[model samples]
Target chain A: MHPIGTVHYLVLSVALLLIGTFGVLTRRNIVVILMSIELILNAANINLIAFSRAVDNVNGQVFAIFVIAVAVAEAAVGLGILIALFRNKETVLADEVDLLKW
Target chain B: MSQFYTSTDHFVLLPAIMLAIFGCAVLLLDFLFPEPKQRKVLALLVLAGLFFSGIGLWRQYSFLTSQGISEITAFRGTLTVDSFALFFNGIFIAVAALVAIVSYRYLELEGEHRGEYYGLILLAQTGMYFLATGTDLVTLFVGLETMALSFYILVGFLRGDKRSNEAAIKYLLLGAFSSGFLIYGFSLLYGISGSTKLRDIGAAIVSRDLWDPLVFMGLTATTVGLLFKISAVPFHMWAPDAYEGAPTTVTAYLAVGSKAASLAFLMRMFLGPFWNMKEIWEPMLIVIAVASMTLGNLAAITQNNVKRLLAYSSVSHAGYMLLGLIAGNETGIKGMMVYILVYTFMTLGAFLVVVGLRRMDVIGDDVDDLSGLMYKSPGYAVLMLIFMLSLAGIPPTAGFIGKYFIFLSLIQTGHYVLAVIATLYVAVAIYYYFRIVRSMFIADLVDKAPLASSVGLRVGLYITGALTLAIGVYPEPFLRMAQVSFGR
Candidate 1:
């Protein structure tokens, strides 16, 4: 097999990005949707790290670290909001949370 | 690292640093006070923070002007202190201050008055400062997340309301999703240029072919992300619900402050790295501009909820602002600055009226709730009328000046078709805006209670209404300000 390279990483990351986008669009479960968002973020992180290596630069890797930190903060906030929502609605289905719709 | 920072960096960053300090101070002081009556002191402290921040911004502006330079790069060129940032920062401070003032009584009425609310406002303003000034992708991304996270919490500040919680979740999910798109694009940009600086990226992009797949993907992804933040058509599903569910005070802030900050970010990205790629993105933005206006105005006609109606109108306003960007001339850029400033005040004034209608027992968000407002509060009703007229871009209001400049820029650029289409939508907008006016004057009262007026709310209304009229009647000073700010 050919050695894994930048293009391989790009292809893999693109797959993850597509899967994440599809999940976000189609999923009815809010928790699952949040996970899909995480996947998309991870996809970016992979792209950043791979590109950093390809370019012989550290800025992309630094950005990836930031992305990971931000992802954690985002997940914390997302779960907190989810708990708040669940407490009120007694359900986690996206379709059921429709109070503000026109 | 020592060489990376200097006194100039601290001086340039003073406003944002002050915001952070004051934000923390407010949070700490809240625990100490813990009394509803004493919370007003927190509001005063918040205002003090904004006042100092404004002073810092002014100092920066005057210093730059005196030096005969338009911009100064701080933090090794990661942050740019320029007329553009100063102008947008002024808008952010004004929006935050107004929201803080009006929020006091509204929050108290809802029994959710807390120190964290004011603290979050300050912190969010701090984030906006970075968005206006940051020249690096890292700084911009961090700043965006800071502002957006604060908003997510603020939107759900009223935990007792199920709608608020639901709105927060929806916003958080969608917001994070969009950031994913943005980061992906940013990563591509980093790979293409091997640097995070916008200048370097611009240099790299200028040498590439127009049909380069990487550049096209980066542009498309970045455009989607920024458009989502601005709540343009097709990406605006979160705005109406979030606006309807959030506290009215927060809704106003979300509508004006957040949109302004995102527009700043958009302008930075487009005018910096993507300037040479205009040919590729201009057609795409034109389509979005038309779709946003058409869909925004048309959908607003049917919205019975005032908040949702304003949300859609804000979307259409986004469309109008995009026309300025699409024109991409000095006049077009100035038009955008003028429009953003005008929009901040008029939109805030309109929401202030809605905030006044809120009482302990009244939801006051439905269109029918505005019935007989003329009889209940003639002064407020008249103020609302001026705001409606301004929003519809009628002459003798600030909004008219904004629209005029935009249309003029479009015509100057030979986009007469766009200019005419925009004018046609003004007529459609007038119809819905007048719907509220008709309900206020011609319809009978559903309730005889006076509006829930407070000192802070009255102050906010007066400032916004007066500015709305002042800018409309004598726009010379404001025009000069916009001209100076766009000089760079």
Candidate 2:
């Protein structure tokens, strides 16, 4: 059996990123879109950590830590906006939140 | 793995540090006061913070010049202080101050004069300062997020307004989605170069001869995020709705301050790290610029909402600025910087006039709302005419000077076809921009009521209007300033 390498990690990361991108484009529910965004970020985290170990440098790991912290802030803000929308229009679907469309 | 810094390094960071502290102070004071009328005090505090930061920035700029130090990279090259950053720092401070002044009357009119509005603007400006000055990918991403998160809340500040909430949600989702692309791209970039410092990455790529497919892919993905931030075409779907739905003052800040900061980051990364790969990236930018100009102008012609029209106009302006980057020379870069400064005034002044009309009887954001504006408020009509003509890139306004520099660089670089295409789009731009002026001056009056604009709104409008004309008439000083900015 082949041991895991940078290539394997990169492949996994790309696959997850593609999945998240698909969810963002296809899903109508805002919650699902938010989840997809999280998935996309986590995929980046996996790549960062993998490269940190592979390159014998901690910079990638440090970047991953910052990414995680920002993700938390982003999640809080996203949900807050989601709740605000739900309160006003009684919907969580992106299609329904279309009052300001050109 | 701790890094040490000297006192001078702290001095270098004074402006951003001052902005952050003042932001929190504004929030605390607002909480203590907690009255609608008292919100004006909070706005004043925010302005004072911005004022002091501007002073700090000026002192820093003089210190750098007097010391004869061209650039200083502190924290292991994570942050940089230089003339380029100082130029943007001035724009950010001015934009923040103007936004605060305009917000005072806007919040009062909406009867939602919360302290957080002012606090959030300061925080966002702080983030902008970092984005402009940061030298490392880590600093850049964190700064971008800080600004993005603040904008998310500010866009939805009017909780009772459905449009504002929708705008906030859309902006938040799209913004977060782009962050994912941005971070993944950063990871890949780090993976390739084994460093997060932009200079180190550029060095690594050059030393290793790493112009493989993966490197190109990583660069492309990273640019996608920056492109979205600047609202370039194919990535600008969120801007129109977000701009229209946001409070008009916040919309102005978004169109001016936030976009300028993003362009600062983009130029630093591309021209600094990716300069060696100019052959690849330049073509991509050219394509994006062309599409943005064509689509933005065509779309603006159909918009009835003035805010939406301005949003699309902002997109086209982004395209024009990109022309400078594609020029890949000193003249082009200077053109980009100058155009941003001029745009800050023209866009902000136009929005202030709209805010002025959002009074007791009229919300003057619709194109039709300006019908017979010369009768109701001749002063405002004339000011709006200056902004509209400037936006259309007519002469005798700063906008023309800005566009002239951009076109000069394009022609100098032999991008004649792109220049011609852009010129035709300028014609389309005039039709729509003049539509507003025609409605106000040429069209018949619908209402004879006098518009009541507050003193704050008047101050904001007059200052920006005066600056627009002053820069246009005497372009020499500004042109020299832009020339001196790059230190080349």
Candidate 3:
């Protein structure tokens, strides 16, 4: 109900970013990490839409749409890749991949 | 000249639409012919369809100019049809052709699903073409996603390969996270400015210091997200695994076509909408550019896998391109365009050699695998050297010219310190690049694979090689053309 301010976005951004960070740093499952990324994107979308609504400009919303589209596409390819990788490594843990580590 | 705006069906926008057509048509063809081999036929058709249409678009260059087809377009002023877009599209088209030709050998021998593979690539190219020419944020996003999504699938196309799959997954998750940041930035700008059009945003910021800190933050976050896409240093963790895991041809597409598309959009964004904010983005970019270069080169120095080395190298190059954008001058922009063109050739050529080496279960990926390439296959060794030297910025190669233009531009802008660092790294780069060259030539051949290729692939390699050499030797034409091409 209140006109959105930067704080609202900061809170949402912090939460989403924290989630993504936690997932990336500690997640055992690759799929879970990916889902966390989606959460982060959704959080961004929320912030964008809130700001867009506050600013009354369509660009933010338009960009959000593209973000969604890209997210879907990225997810499709990512899962396909995951499926492929699991087929080979038989595990989804991030630590399992050391084929190219220095 | 005032022909149409509401039509949304302009021939000027044919490349964008044609991609969707090719993508869907492949699906339809697959329905009609379900056999695995039929996928190849469909892929060929998609490539051919895109090729003919792309050539058709190129032919209309004169007509487009004379008729003022640009001014007669819709979306008000959100998109442009200037020589810049056409020039970029031309590069993209040439790239698509190279990839398409390479794919014939790459996908077939590697036994990837032709329908999904070629269709996604065509679709991605279409997105890139749109993104390159997109005047507004909306079209740019749409185009970028179309390409990005396809790439996600592409990076993981060889689902059989664990590394490829892991790479794809990592890229997707990180890529999406970054997209969120990018969109949030766009929204903040929109909120502050009340416009999606580049000109509108620029005009709003130019007339007054009404722009706010939040907007700057949004922009920075967005840049961070996109930084990942181009595989810039901090955002570059995904590239090596993805590059190594994905099919070699897909790696080329990511390195060449995808990066080109993103950079084109970034050029417009920084030089156009964000131009007024140069004081803000410049120093920030310089920090990033330095980081990307130093990190990428240093990391590359430690890599034994050829694919991973190239991946890190590309991340560093993306940083280099950013230097041009950081300068925020016409020369800076032109340098970026020139470097990208050269980058496309050198990176793609290097990858083609990688693709050439990947035979049966043996992917010609590791540094050790390249040992004694001189005796095993002198031709590939020479090609790899062109790639390595070009990458190292050696003279008589496109990489050198690309780096030279950026250095020249940076020096012109009084970034002597950064230039000094970049040059030092250039020296550092020589060692790693030479490591590959030495391995290919000096070391003994541990494993030798037959250089098997039909005429088309061999011809493709020759054309790519010749272009790499020709552009490297005589870059004036490219520089002039790139300068005259876009909204600048």
Best by DockQ: 2
Better of 1 and 3 by DockQ: 1
Tens-digit lDDT string for candidate 1 (B239-345): 99999999999999999999999999999999899999999999999999999999999999999999999999999999999999999999999999999999999
Scored by lDDT, model 3 comes in at: 0.77
Over B325-396, each residue of candidate 3 has an lDDT whose tens digit, in order, gives: 876567777788888889898888888887887777777788888889899888888988888888889889
Candidate 3: misplaced stretches above 4 Å? A1-26, A55-81, A84-90, B1-9, B31-39, B67-73, B207-211
TM-score of model 1 relative to the true fold? 0.99
Q: Between prediction 2 and prediction 3, which has the larger DockQ?
A: 2
Steric clash pairs (candidate 3): A77-B152, A77-B153, A81-B165, A84-B159, B78-B135, B78-B136, B79-B135, B83-B485, B84-B485, B84-B486
Winning candidate number (TM-score): 1
As a whole number from 0 to 100, the lDDT of residue A62 in candidate 1 is 92
In model 1, the Cα lDDT at residue B282 comes to 96
Model with the higher TM-score, candidate 1 or 3: 1
lDDT of 1 at B293: 98
lDDT at B85 for candidate 2?
92
The complex in candidate 2 yields a DockQ of 0.93
